[model samples]
Target: MYYIHLEGVPMQCVLVWLWHIVRSLTSIEKILLRDRPQTLYDLSSKGTVPVLQLADGSVIDESVDIMKWALKRNDPEHWYKENFDHQDGLVNKNDEIFKKRLDRYKYHVRFPERSYQDHRADVSEILNEYNSLLEPGPYMFGKDICFTDIALMPFVRQCAHVDLEWFNSSFPELGAWLDRLKESELFISIMVKYPIWNESESGQYVTWE
Candidate 1:
């Protein structure tokens, strides 16, 4: 099963996207952080949503780890190809650096000392760097979709959402690249909303065929 929040939870969005890409059979539980269910707290009180509860009763809590687990089971796209370290490095940078800038920029009220433009500029540098990397693209790594593309797109989407006008005008290639992923059937498929979880119920399940 997958636990997700509807509003701008990039990790949850990415995990669901990866599952669709891998064609994995799984159920999903929608959750709101403000009203976290006991069932979720039972799994990992400290852990956030996007937890993947395996049938064996083990749980994968980290989003990237979940992506690796899903892909390892069946990499029909062969995303686990040569230069995997390089691909993983990109994902690491997105998680570590880009996401940090994103949070601060998006939730700038939490850090009143820093101006929104300062954080946005920091994130823009990261996007510009990615734009340079993606110059050879229709996708991130040459002509096809890869692990890095799938893993990073959701975060980029989040950043763009912060200011669509700035993102579109300032980062044209990056904007265009994101547009492709957003328009994809794969992205659209996983974005289907499930009912929000109720604490008293056993909850609904969404299994793959």
Candidate 2:
């Protein structure tokens, strides 16, 4: 897995780590994008983070695509068994719309057209929509955590951290949902800091099984 560590989250990398934990997979090499060798670009010209090269020499670059590939092999918790359309719908909204607003809000100075408050208001609208979805209790679909929950959790966490006080006050349900996932054993395990991978030396391999 090749990923860039940003604010200690490394968004998409953590998504793949969640699947790896549930599937009991083993032997993944963690490479920092900043220290990635030219071989990585040779493998995929797109040069994105969280790139996974399988034993079969096939590559999976997109984050959600990597999640689907892993789950297809083993999904003991049945994360993909139910809510197919609903899951896809929410994940798409998160990746496409919510992420854009989040980036703008996070780096509002880069987007001079909109004030920081305007960018935050745009994100708040989407957060409110997701908050309403958690109407009665936990998780996106129901009590059980499904594909949608895992897919959107990291991004929501990023937004919440921007202003945690406001997030908790404005959307308690969403804040709670983020906290539950953040405090999980699985989340904690993946968060162990590894030395930055270097081309001149052997990189760190995280054994998941």
Candidate 3:
């Protein structure tokens, strides 16, 4: 699934779900091009992150919706298959509640009154739930990595960085999971620095060289 966003696409937590699925499937039968779908805004001016353009010149703009669009076509990662039960109605809840808290925690200045710890506390409760789930495993979905695991990781990864010591002290299991993701090749491929607007000279989606 090549996210056909113009110039390039910025790396975010949401992209991880689609990324893991695409990598695991490794099926390039069709060039799933993702672009900031041609929009009234992009048509008039620069639009959002997920403007997608299809081979037939079709387009999709919103990022979160795009993840669903890409995932629906394939189930190699079972993103839609396994994670879709309450995903339609409930996925957005976590996205709404926890995601909002995460962003504020990462960039606490916007929420000026709240200390970083206070902001983290708001989200840590959710992470602790995940920690309990991981009682006897590494990946969120049993032995291997799954859509559920990757979907929520990027933001958590960002939070872990907000205060490594603090997050470690507060939520060790979630912190451990974040630590594991940092060391994983997937994290290296997706999070590694590359030109946000241009593929490196080697012309890769991610180039950490």
* Backbone atom clashes (below 3 Å) for every candidate: 0, 0, 10
Give the CA lDDT, 0 to 100, for residue 69 in model 3. 66
- Alpha-carbon TM-score of each model against the true structure: 0.88, 0.88, 0.68
User: Best candidate per lDDT, number?
Assistant: 2
Tens digits of per-residue lDDT for model 3, 1-209:
24344333344423543354443322111111343323324432545444555555556655566666666655564655664664443356567788888888878888989897788788787878777766668766556665566666766777677778877877776777778877887667654333333222222342112
Quote the positional error of residue 150 for candidate 2 in Å. Answer: 1.0
Predicted candidate 2 versus true structure: per-residue lDDT over 125-194, tens digit per residue: 9999889988777988888887788888888988998999999999989998899888877677677665
What clash count does candidate 1 reach? 0
What residue pairs clash in candidate 2, if any at all?
Answer: none
Preferred candidate (lDDT higher): 1 or 3? 1
Error of 1 at 88 (Å): 1.2
Which runs of model 1 end up more than 4 angstroms from their true locations?
1-25
RMSD of each candidate? 2.6, 2.9, 6.5
lDDT of every model, 2 decimals? 0.74, 0.74, 0.57
